[model samples]
Target: MEGVSPEPLRSELDSKSKHDTAKEDDDALKDSTEAEVTKIRLMRAFVESRDPSSKEENDLMMRRFLRARSLDVEKASAMFLKYLKWKRSFVPNGCISPSEIAEDIAQDKVFTQGLDKKGRPIVVTFAAKHFQSKNGADGFKRYVVFVLEKLCSRMPPGQEKFLAIADIKGWAYVNSDLRGYLNSLSILQDCYPERLGKMLIVHAPYMFMKIWKMIYPFIDENTKKKIVFVENKKLKSTLLEEIEESQIPDIYGGQMPLVPIQNS
Candidate 1:
């Protein structure tokens, strides 16, 4: 008892302990962030080494790949490198031009309008309007890239992903292009990892299910989870839940008119 500290000294010690704990937590967080930054730097270096001509990609883009691979530097690096290779070969010009996809552009099927409630850019595709081109699947593939690039360009600051609405109200077997669908899926999941915030497949007829079944197996598990087949009756209400009425397109019973991807 003689050596014991008084109550005021004990209270001061307790306060100091709490302060130390808080400082430790903050230091830990800072260290974690620094470590991640280092990893991103390493990933960027690896990508650039493989693709000498690669335009410098931003940290946020690298972070998307890193997160997709659970922050495993090796896996993220590999994925990012593959993307660079694909871009170099597929989009040799750096960006898909409207002229290259003139036929698909003329279809006026793809549109990008206002942002969703969460600020993600909205892309609406009329599946019925898509038909297999006589030229081949390459044109469609380029069109997909063009549309995606346009959507990415429209993304608001701090928003990295986009919302897509696939309206298949009149889609029939004649419009089916399995090759194009598969190719588009590959580009989205492999080349553009983590870029899709959500996709609503509205008015998906029973016939579409057959094609979907074949395509579903090829989709990444995470991507499959983001795909929602909106019920016909619930289309408007369900969309309103995630998108504001003002942003919804006129065809879907909302006010906004669909802006062509080339123009949007």
Candidate 2:
């Protein structure tokens, strides 16, 4: 009994099951490859049908559109085309020079610094420094792009995400501009999909929490999941766990200094 092998029929069944599983895995892989090929063809055809002379045939660009639209070919194509149109109008020169929004850069409100432990960039926003003005909305929008561009420029290969910390120290009703906050959130969450890794709201006052309740409903569930509220007591420890002490600023009980971008 100690040396007994499995019965002949049971051994054969086990062998057959292993072979079946291997074959199933192979078939699944082949099916996935074929589906990807078909999707690429469909994406190209859709773009060509709309713009015969289009030069956007890169697979990465197509994949970005697919991701933006959840891999629906028709929707992705439309979104890509619309993006092209918007890009042309928003950035006619295909670039946003630092000089274009010099005044906005002077605000010293938003700036992205060192990377976290996961290599994701860190964006720090001082709400107390940001004040809404009627004539500054457009410039502020450009500044948003400028901040994104700065962070994106710093992104190393294979890194596609970033973190944010909104410092609400000294923030009051005068600093709370509901319309501006919504617009900025939309630009970051909607226009720039899949970029945010997390957004920590630190030192939020009771009044700020009340404002957040109103604005929270407008945020998508996916974006909402990326947000976290940390009280002043926990701010240092919570941030230190995710980011390096040198990377974080002294204002947040870290060693780093908050240096505003002098030129860009």
Candidate 3:
């Protein structure tokens, strides 16, 4: 009797302890959210101070950079500023015109017709149809921007990424464009962070694997995770896993026809 508290007193103490623990957890969560918000505001201010002409800047865009940089405000700010500078110089007129990339578009290699299960827009590229342009790297670079911007425009609200399918079935050495591939990787990774939802490489032959091996090293770890090489035997079934059969392109045994990127 002398060693224990009364039953009523013990019950009241237990309830108070539980309430205190819950309050502590709530306070911690609130503090963490406020800290993140503060960081985002600081980053927005810093980026705007450096690039006042960034009319398209907003919290969502800033958040993308922040997430890409693991929420490091300084690093995200620097990356965002670099992107702004590159966009200003490369896209001086504000957007890449179809006429400017007419040759690449005429190749009809790139198409976008449907969305994945996640609602991300789909982009299909027929590598066999793409030949290295006589106009050099600049034209191809602009073409990449054009295609990417077009795909981005098609994204629905709240969706920030798109899916890619590269059909290299008939690809040969003649279709090889190492510089073009490197430029594309650089632009996608550096300029358009977190924009690629996934990339499906279909019917990739032995020669293509060698090219991929070379290109693979340049891909960042995060981007590399999104790439998938579908087996020939399971191409249709594999594609069906992430895309509705109706939305898959006819060429891949799905219902939809391939719409050229320029047209879509």
Best by lDDT: 3
Q: Global CA lDDT of candidate 3, please?
A: 0.87
Worst 10 residues of 2 by lDDT: 24-33
- Predicted candidate 2 versus true structure: per-residue lDDT over 1-264, tens digit per residue: 467666976899889987775564345334234555577668878887887644544444565556556678888787767766766688778667778777656667876667888898887888988778546677667667767767766775556678989889899988988877887787775556667888998888888888888899999777888899997778889999889999887777777666564332
**Count of clashing residue pairs in every prediction:** 0, 0, 0
Q: What is the lDDT of residue 29 in candidate 1?
A: 35
- Evaluated at residue 12, the lDDT of candidate 3 is 90
Order the candidates by lDDT, highest first — what do you get?
Answer: 3, 1, 2
TM-score of 2: 0.76
Instruction: Please write out the lDDT profile of model 1 over residues 91-186, one tens digit for every residue.
Output: 998899888888998888998888899899999999999999777988899999988888888876567789999989899999999999999999
Please, what is the TM-score per model?
Answer: 0.83, 0.76, 0.85
Residue 262 CA displacement from its true place in model 1, Å: 1.3
